[model samples]
Target: ATPSRPASGSASPARTSAKPARTSAAPEPARIPGPGYDSSADAQKQIEAALRAAKADGRAVLLDFGANWCGNCKAADKVFAQPQTAGILGASYHLVKIDIGGNSSANSALLRKYSPSGGTYTMPVLVVVSSSGTVRTDTHVTGNPSLTADGINAFLRKWAS
Candidate 1:
């Protein structure tokens, strides 16, 4: 006789097995530094250093512009630090965070160089630049909605290569 199906709401008997099912825990997300707007005159020096490193590594530069006080910026940082996203970023790009200050003028001149409007006017702006210092992804004019995990992953996938 065939075994009968369990009732709609009844609990099924637990089967005993010598070996337990193998399960692996998910990896912890990467933790990045909190945003702090840099106001030093040598900010450009720091950027140049990152660009050089990107060139040496044959990777692109991922410039993140925001202040520590911005909630959206913090959220974007967290999403970038997630394991899957971090791996892609770590392998393909050199990351740099530039604080644009509360008024968005802390690094206005430097920011204008990459922005289409030639202005440092947006918070949480992400710009991808090639090792040769050419802009790859310009988020200034059209704006990018990559603050969320899905959007960020898609953006990285599109530019990381």
Candidate 2:
């Protein structure tokens, strides 16, 4: 599961002076490290970079589309974190977590562009793409997030080689 990283503002304390005159503080949500990635457009850039990096190493582009608040996605992450899954993913794919809701407009657009036509599906949409930016296969494995690790590896092996 993704850790709730400290917000950038909370990472360090503010410098204070010797004489204290006023005291006023407000509450704010904790800043997470990987939460706010530039913007949706910027996220696409990162995904593109990931794809290019994969092409450089002769690996497949593994697009993992899910929102940050998705419980299924979190569980999927754990399954994907397993030793065997990690080994294969690390060896032959660009495992990218593309957010689908909240501020992830670009990610949602990408999903609609390639996946179903009527509406969006549940979290953890596992899509496989080629180096030429062509989508090979698409599957929604959020039903059994934990069971998707094996399925994901199988997909990569099928196309990566």
Candidate 3:
């Protein structure tokens, strides 16, 4: 004789007999130590070097202004290091990370040469400079809150070769 079935709407005992599959724990996100933000370094000299490299490589210069203590800066660094953004940035620009000393007046004074109109004291400001050392005003990106993957990708695409 055939085995009896459970009620029409009920789950049969056989259906519940199988054990649940075990799932492994998800891996932790990588904590990449990005380009260091040096407070004591000469910012101008570093930018000059990057500019020279950019000129030689037929690319632009990307100045990353931020402090190591800024969480937003770190997040932006992560976005910049992503494969998509990194590939574009690597191919089109020479990158220079400059610590702004937490927006000190001295650092602001140094940054004024690139942003003469002011208002670039924000952390993680991205300044795109031509190989000739002219800051591309239209390419200046500020505010870490706006530094999402799409936003960064768009910015890179707009400025990259």
Candidate 4:
């Protein structure tokens, strides 16, 4: 089971301000934190719950596989938080973000089950599953496009069933 984490909602991108002037003192190590996703979650159970809910609501399940340390995953989260994409997601899909952790093996079984191309998966992979537990789209084969608002919105709209 993966650890419990923040609800799978779209998170706003980190805001960057002007850097503070360096002092004569030694510099501190940079620490960058990405979005919070449950690395210890029971992905199978989550998927089952989502599938049941989606079946009732005539919606699909969106499985987002990535690690919190992944830059591209963070960028994708920002796109998801945008109003246009968020609306579509809320209306049509049950979003589940599965954190792979640094080793990318947190949920290997789920990853392999949904992987369309092969066993290998890139970070921020997306798998769209129908309410009936059928895989509709696997980004492992299709490839995740640019993490732009328009691109994500279009993708969501296209596979929203």
Candidate 5:
């Protein structure tokens, strides 16, 4: 299900003055400081390395599919970096951040490989693959920039190797 924020209440019909109004329908996503995805990096190679490490360590592979410009992805990264969630992830998963570019075609094949038949993907999709290379979970992070520690922790615990 798509996560949605509660409406900020309807605009007063009579009171309208927006200096000509904004062009974009959606509000700009808020960004967080972090190392964004390396689009030029060989994602396939990275995944293979991570899979090897995961296999050796008896851990799962966390394929974080997202783009550098994705605010939600950055937010999820922040959550993962938190000590609590970080420990859970570090112990049980080999994280591979895959950059799905502007058109969502950069890693399209892998996305399709991991997705359900005819499944539509959103930004910041998290595909959890076991050490044996079997997909355990293909899901979206909590939501937008408001992704929380508890939520992330739950997800990690549920799928942790």
Candidate 6:
């Protein structure tokens, strides 16, 4: 038995395009603060130290609030793995990543202690803080900043300036 095609304008068969194979090697990614800091408190301590170091080095603290499941977070993760991005940020700022998944209390506490008034609690949030416990830029990427490095860099420049 032969299968007949659908009648004209009667919902055509589904079609899918075959993607071309990709072989080019992606550039090396930026490595974030690995999991050798000790514990949560230790992480906080490291964060504080980073702030001090940034101040001493005339830089800022960039706090990235995200979880392992977030798509945007995943993208930003790739950005964080980029050497150029890491070098740039490391030279001019302290990069901090917080997994705001379970234990909302910790995330909430951090947010309360640092976030500015009227600041919305959202995932994948990027905050630039000064050494003096001041908020510089609480700009929300709402997605991956990887695609907008220039924009983020511009913001960083303006804030640092």
CA lDDT, every prediction? Answer: 0.70, 0.61, 0.68, 0.76, 0.72, 0.60
Off by over 4 Å in 2: 1-41, 140-149
The candidate that achieves the highest lDDT relative to the unseen native structure: 4
Residue 122, candidate 2: alpha-carbon lDDT: 71
lDDT of 3 by residue, 6-32 (tens): 453245544554433223332222222
- State every prediction's TM-score relative to the real structure: 0.70, 0.64, 0.68, 0.74, 0.70, 0.63
Question: What overall lDDT, based on C-alpha atoms, would model 5 receive against the true structure?
Answer: 0.72
Weakest 10 consecutive residues, lDDT, candidate 3? Answer: 21-30
What stretches of model 3 exceed 4 Å from their correct place? 1-36, 102-106, 138-145
lDDT of 4 by residue, 87-135 (tens): 7777788888887764545487678877746666777898999999899
Question: Please, what are the lDDT tens digits per residue for candidate 6 over residues 71-153?
Answer: 76666656655666666665667777776655656665675566545455556777888877588777553332434566555
Off by over 4 Å in 5: 1-34, 103-106, 140-146
Candidate 2 C-alpha error for residue 155, in Å = 3.7
Q: TM-score winner between 1 and 6, please give it.
A: 1
Residue 95 C-alpha lDDT in model 2:
62
Please rank every candidate by TM-score, starting with the best.
Answer: 4, 5, 1, 3, 2, 6
Error of 5 at 78 (Å): 1.2
**lDDT tens readout by residue for model 2, 123-158:** 677777776778777775323223467665565567
lDDT of 4: 0.76
- Per-residue lDDT of 65-146 in model 5, one digit per residue for the tens? 8888888887888898787877777777778888786554647777777765445567788888999999988774333223
